[model samples]
Target: MDTQTLIYIFVGGTFALYIGIALWSRAASTKEFYVAGGGVHPVVNGMATAADWMSAASFISMAGLIAFSGYDASVYLMGWTGGYVLLALLLAPYLRKFGQFTVPDFIGTRYYSKTARVVAVICLIFISFTYIAGQMRGVGIVFSRFLDVDITLGVIIGMGIVFIYAVLGGMKGITYTQVAQYCVLIFAYMVPAFFLSFMITGTPIPQIGLGSQVNDGSGMFVLQRLDAVLTDLGFQAYTSGSKSMIDVFCITLALMVGTAGLPHVIVRFFTVPKASDARKSAGWALVFIALLYTTAPAVGAFAMLNFVDDVNETQYSEVDDWFTKWEGYGLTAFQDKNGDGVMQYRPGDAFEGAPDYSGETGPSGERALANTPNPESENEVYVDKDIMVLANPEIANLPPWVIALMAAGGLAAALSTAAGLLLVISSSVSHDLLKSTFAPGISPKQELLAARLAATAAIIVAGYLGIYPPGWVAQVVAFAFGLAAASLFPAIFMGIFSKSMNKEGAIAGMVSGLVFTFVYIAYFKLVAPAANSADNWLLGISPEGIGVIGMVINFAIAIAVSRFTASPPVEIRRLVDSIRVPRGAGDAQGH
Candidate 1:
């Protein structure tokens, strides 16, 4: 069968499976809608959690970005993986023991204030929405390329699928659907890695392949060869990072804490039956996540090597079918700057057009009658980095079915996270904002209706953001993580660990931390980003790393305020001590 037919069949089959799952798992109550009745098996919930947490960035974009950026991308691997450890250690068990419907629920009750609950809701909304845009955008990018549709159409198709399943079954639907998605996405991701790895390095394990010598009989390790290739082209080494060490540390720390604090991730534990299960499930979630994380670096390295080997300094007319096809999509552009009818891939002002070479010294220097020099001039062919992974299969001449699987996998990753975020938004709007605070007397039936409506609306907005994408999708998503770390993680941690913390202190810390982090990101990443350089940042922290400082600020302010304030209420103090004591804590009052 042709590639287009294969994609349609594969994508259609996965959508059918998800819709069937949604229909079969209709949620009947608010509890079911929000937390899958808080009775899911730990391993199943862990798989669902992995699907929900990975997002489009991990499945589609991260490896592609890593392919081009090289070793600097390790920050994502280390930071994201480490955060789950924090979750398993500091946050998941306590929150699951608390057994509320949402993050804001714990915050509201723990702080004994409607204001705190509302603040938590605001932060959750911002973080979830920001992250969902990236997911939706990922859906768009995948569909746009594979199906030959406009990005807007792709986002709409994804939104339609999500609207059906998410609005129908809520968390119950999302959880089961994510289980299926996890399976599909992981298989799809690994197949490419396996094929590409063995093709180049005679190793099926990507992590090993990254360290193994190339099949080209070069004694150098794959990374060593990759680094040589990169440096030869004036780019930084692939194995040795180019970013400043401090920025790397701060970004990694921020991601770890942010992962721990992310409301969508934390709320997944609420679906499980026990505090112990929550902790165990977090470990399993990492197992599921690590499958992709470990393979990504190898995929990235192999993809780059394949890409450069194929097109570097080759004649434009003689480039492979993949090159020609990608070029038609505007993803690959060629300009024959010093037109000799051959390709010149390097960094210059002159394009691939048949330009005069008689008097020109070229963008860097005169064209050689000798072997092709890696030019300092602008590359004749410009390839979009984002297209790297999606195009990898075709570039490597993999079987057409594998290309179809990539499409299905990309959709699976995107839709799973989209459903998870919509649940967070729906739960916040229905349970926290409306039912709990504004309409306390609302019927369960009415609240369920409200949840579905809110989900529908959130999906619509998410779809819109996917289409227009507001330009800061990556930064905004990253900023959401920073805000989670800086604004929420400390409060959540201290709520369990500190017995003497009062509502006054927790509230003050959270608010101050939020403002501090959000404003810094806005200033550097969004507001006056021209001032985002290292010299302008405090302690030379990049906008990406500023959240580490913001987190410290929260810890400092919370402790200082607690020292001067009255201790927690007698009941709240008892509650803290109760949570700390694990005896008989298994099912402690499931909300």
Candidate 2:
């Protein structure tokens, strides 16, 4: 079968399985819709959490980012994986013991204030939306390239698939679908890496192959060879650090803590049968995630080597079939400076060559092009990072079947996370907003309808955002982590650890954190955009790292405000005590 047909079959099969599961496990009660009745097995919940946590960013953009950025991109690898450790050790079990349907429910009851609950809901929405935007973009890129559809159409189709499972099954539907997604995505990611590793180093395992000696006549290791070649071409060493120590520390910390704080991820723990199960589930989730995480660096290194070898040294217009082919999809660009047919991919420092069209020239100037206008533009460099994962099979000359698997994997990653995030938004709106605050006397049937309505509305909004994403998938994803770190993490942490934390304190902390992080992001990314070649970011820190600072401010303000407020009532104190115990799970999510 052709690649397109294979892709359609694989993607179609996966969606069919998800829809079938959703239909079979259709939620019948508010509890089932919101928390899957807290009845899923620990291992299954763990797999679901892995799918929830590892979005399209992890499956598609992460390895690609690492591929080009060299050692500077280690932040993603360490930060994202390390967050699961934090979740398992510090948060998941206790939150499950607290037994709430949503994060806002925990905050409202824990702080004994409805206002605190509303604030948490707002933060959850912001984080979830930021996250969903990236997934939408990812789905678009995958469809445009593999399925031969326009990106807009790809996004609409993706939305249709997600809406079917998410609206039909709620948490129950999403959880089962996510488990299936985890398998498809992880297998898709590993197959190419293993094949490429075996081809290059005679080792089937990529992690081991990365550290093994290269078979390319050179006696040096793969890492050493990659470093040597890239440096000779003016790129940084593959294994050595390029970013400042402080920037690395901040970005890594932000992602680590931010991962633990993400509502979509944390909510998965609520579906497990017991508090102990939540703790065990987190451990399994980390194991599933680490399978891909450990292999990612190897994939990154291999893809980088393939990229430099394929495009940089070769003539752009006269290069291999792949170059012209991808250009058809708008990913590779070529411009002939000085009207020369040969494309030069080198450092921009040389004045003799044409103006640098590389993104490094900053955003102010138009892209540099050679004398030719249409057929032979001046400076053409086209390699979208999103293509890195999907194109890896082709780069390595793997079997067509392997390539088909990757297409399925990309769709799985996008759809699984979309379902998880949609569930969080739906539950927060229907269960927390409508039933809890707006109408406490709401019936289970009414609440279920409300949840379905909220889910439908959220799906529409998600579709809109996916159809018209504002930024690159990876960078937009970073904003979601930032918002989670600054606003939700601190508030939830304080609400649990500090009994005296009041409504004013919680609101103040959340507002301060949210506003500070948002303004900092807007300042760097959109507002008052920088003018220099060097990014004029504060302290060389990107907006993604500003969350650590914002989180600190949230913690400080909440602590100060709590000291001045009256202590919690005896009943509230008793409630806090009850939540800390696994046996009190029923009372934790009080009726």
Candidate 3:
């Protein structure tokens, strides 16, 4: 079969599987909807958590970021993985033991104030919505390329699929569906890695392939060869980083804390039966997540090598089929700067802005650009980094089935995380905002209905954001992580660790951290893009790394404010101590 038919088979099959799982596991009660009835096995929940945690950023964009940014992008790998460790050791078990359906629920009960819960809900909404936008955009990219549809129509189709499963199955359906998704996505990711690795380095293991000498007669190791190629093209060496040390540390710290604080991931621990299971599931999730995390660097190196080798200095008439297909989507473009009828891929912008296609073709049959070319730059290409992974198989001439599998995998990764984020948003609205605070007397059935309606609304909003994303997939996700780090991590950490922390302090700290981070990011990202460089940044911290400072501000302000405020009530302090003690620990100690 041809590539298109194969994509139809693979993508259609996966969608069917996801919807069938949703129908089979339709949630019946509020508990089922929110936490999958809290009966999931640790292993199963771990797989589900991996799928939920690995969003479009992880599956579709992280490797692409690594491919382009090289050593500088290592922060994503370190921060996200380290953050999981923080969650597992410091937060997950304790939160699961707290027995709250949502993060807002824990804050509300722990602080003994409705205001604290509402604050957390607001933070959760902001973080989840920002994060979901990237996932929905990933869905659109996959559908646009493989299914040959407009990105807006693709997002609508994705929204419909997620709405059915998310509104029907709730956490119960999403959890099971994610397990299936994990299988599909991991297999899809690894197959190409194995193929490319063996083809380039004669090694099946991507990790080993990354370090092995290339099969080419020159016999240079992968990184060495990549460094040589990039530097020759007037780009920074692939193995060396250009970011300042402080910025790297801050971005990594922010991502770590942000991962721990993400409400969607934290809520996954609640689906388990007990604190022990939460810990167990977290361990299993690390193993599952590592399968992709470890492979990403190798895949990125191979992709960059392949891309440059295939496209750089190639004749426009002889460009690969993948190049033309992607260019048609306006993701890949070229300008004949020297009128050489050849495409040169180099560093820096090719045009003043994003490619503005005028619905016309050039003499060489390439898409004609309306945007003015950058007069000072020699670069003649603009390839969206997001397309690197999806185009990898096509660029390498992998089998039709492999390319099709990539399409399915991308959708699975995007949809799984989107479903998780939507659930978090819906639960915050229905469970925390309505049933807990606004309508404490609401019936369980009514709350369930409300949750479904809330999920439907969230999906619609998420779809809209996906159609018009604020930034690249990984960049947008990084901002969400920063927001989570600033607003939620400190609150949750202090809630469990410090008995003296009061509602007044918690509320104040969250608001201040959130506002500071949001304003800093907006100032550079939206308000003043021209001044976003290192020289203009505060303490030389870019917007992506500023969240670490916001987190510190939260910690400092919460501690300072708590010193003058009343201590938490006696029972609340006792409750804090109780959660700190592991479940059944007293029994194990013969208490």
Q: Give all TM-scores, in the order shown.
A: 0.92, 0.92, 0.96
Instruction: Provide the global lDDT of candidate 3 against the true structure.
Output: 0.90
Which of candidates 1 and 3 is the stronger one according to lDDT? 3
How would you encode candidate 1's per-residue C-alpha lDDT over 471-533 as one tens digit per residue? Answer: 455456567888999888988888888888777787888889889988888887667755767
How many pairs collide in each candidate, listed in order? Answer: 10, 9, 0
What digit string (tens of lDDT, one per residue) describes model 2 on residues 1-591?
877788888888988998898998889998889889899998898898888888888898788888877788899888898878987888888888888899999888887788888988998998898888768767887888788898889988988888888888989988898899999999999999999888778889999999998778789888898889878876667788867787888899999888889999888888998788998998898889899999999998888887777777576556766567666765555655555566555544222222222222223221122233333332235465657888888876688889889999999998899888888999999888888898999999988888888888888888777776543333345578788889888877876666777777877888898889888876656555443213676677777688898899888888788788777778877776666655756678994
Off by over 4 Å in 3: 355-370, 470-476, 584-591
TM-score, structure 2 vs. true: 0.92
On a 0 to 1 TM-score scale, where does candidate 3 land against the true structure?
0.96
Q: Give the winner by TM-score.
A: 3
Residue 136 displacement in candidate 1 (angstroms): 1.0
Better of 2 and 3 by TM-score: 3
Tell me which of candidates 2 and 3 scores higher on lDDT.
3
Which tens-of-lDDT digit does each residue in 307-414 have in candidate 3? Answer: 999999899999999999998887788888999999998877787654221111222222224467888789998777778889999989999999999999999999
**Alpha carbon lDDT at 87, candidate 1:** 88
> Against the true structure, candidate 2 has what lDDT?
0.79
Model 1 residue-pair collision total: 10
Model 1 C-alpha lDDT versus the unseen true structure = 0.84
Off by over 4 Å in 2: 338-340, 348-380, 471-475, 531-540, 581-591
